[model samples]
Target: MTKPTLADLTAFSAVATHRSFRRAADALGVSRSSLSHAMLALERDLGVRLLNRTTRSVSPTEAGEALLARLAPVLRDLDDALDAVADARGNPSGTLRINANESAARLLLKTVVPLFLKRFPSMALDLVAEGRLVDIVERGFDAGVRLGESVPRDMVAVRISDDLRFVVVAAPSYLSGRTPLITPDDLRNHDCIRQRLPSGKRYRWEFRKHGEEMAIDVPGVLTLDHNGLMVEAASDGLGLAYVPESTARDWLDDGRLVTVLEDWCPFIPGLCLYYPGHRHVPAGLRAFIDVLREVNH
Candidate 1:
């Protein structure tokens, strides 16, 4: 029995990931022939064909996929460990991948990231603005930001912002000739600006007051998917838009948009940073969480 070498595993991993010897060689900064020889040596030593190769392409065998499922993380951890040791001697340094909604990312960039970066100059932050839910760990993300209620129960979460409220508003010009909507029932007769979800269904306008809550299936002349676009269209006097109160505050203050049925607007859970409970969080993530606690506390 012979001991496996790091080079053997790395070449196999690279080829498995790239699915082409030429691409794998480019990624590993080696010649194609050298990479092919290394894999052949590895297969000879292991006495198994780990990869199925053809003239035009390369693919992993069944055993290769299982090996990849196990080794990919292990190799990644090995690389991370090396970086950690180097980082410990100098500064807290690593890329922090965070998935968040566009609004939260905007808020963090405006309010949180400046302070965090001033303190840890070496850290890199990749904040992805995505509306859909993501499996942070499986997707190689350090953490995710979502509404408190939207966070998965299996993950640990820390509050980053206070409660949020949603408001229904329309541009002053658009409302000039239209009758004011005093109640949710009035919205049915108005040209509401509706938002479409990622799944292509129109978002239902919801309202609540005291102890009663209801969803209004209001008709609209225009529909959009992005909140930023919805706000812009409403500001241009297209139609009424139901949006987060915080997002509409500036427009409302400027008198460009008028809030309607304020009493019916509901306060909901705000943004939270959530991560897997079972895994050891990286130093970069720990530092971010610490800053969140300090700021929100």
Candidate 2:
């Protein structure tokens, strides 16, 4: 008797549900040719034609339909049983992969993880501190953190932080000898520490006042992609930096970094935990999101 493999079952199930090799291939993140080949091998092993393939479409044969009908619920129960085990543990146990910008990740590290671990000590968090917006589904991330405004419409987002403001801050030593910059336009002459986006482009500094918004491509001598690095450089008097007010709170209180253009900087949306819609959200993820909501509340 030939033993059934999980891969064979998964491939069969995907194709059965989608009814098309191309659609199944797209969902499984495999080439159409690979899916077709797998089906062929599966048919060969069983000595039966499972699918009636045509130039335009593919449909399961009667035997294949019967097999799928018997297997689907069993597979579903297997998955549910595994999930139940994870849920029965009460505390999540597994590696949670997340993609986020440097700033958002820092915020999460400071506030979210402590509480998360308190509730679910066994869960391991792997954070990729990146500046690029990654496709969470394609990249295989459980979730991603981003600024609320930056999250796509198709994604479901939960606000993790209150509205945050970006402020222009400079080391007291750097501002000592320079002319005081009261307006956003004054940034044109000053050396600002710029943030280079992951797309190999400079991030424009946006300012708004009295309902008027403007994006300024400020000239700068220092540029970095990491927000923490930019903060350090600004603290060392490299140049004025546009940073989140939350991050500069310590520097501002201690008189290390002076806030400039305070009126121009206004509160925008804050950090959000976002993920794809329609996908089966794991129980672990559901619990984590609930924790986030409780903490935020």
Number of clashes in model 1? 0
Best by TM-score: 1
Residue-by-residue lDDT tens digits, candidate 1, 36-131: 999888888888888999999899999888887898899879877966774587456867888998888998898778878888888988888888
- lDDT, candidate 2, at 263: 92
* Count of clashing residue pairs in every prediction: 0, 0
Per-residue alpha-carbon lDDT of candidate 2 for residues 1-297, written as tens digits (9 for 90 to 100):
256588887888878777878767755668989889888888888888888889997888998899899998888677667668888877557666778988778778887778887888778777788788877765557799999889988998989888999999889889887888977889999999999888999999999999998899999978898766777889999998998887788888998888889999989988899988866667668878887888778
Off by over 4 Å in 1: 1-61, 68-90, 177-179
Candidates in order: C-alpha RMSD to true structure: 5.5, 6.6
lDDT agreement with native, every candidate:
0.84, 0.83
Model 1 residue 231 distance off true place after TM-score fit, in angstroms: 2.4
Count clashing pairs, candidate 2. Answer: 0
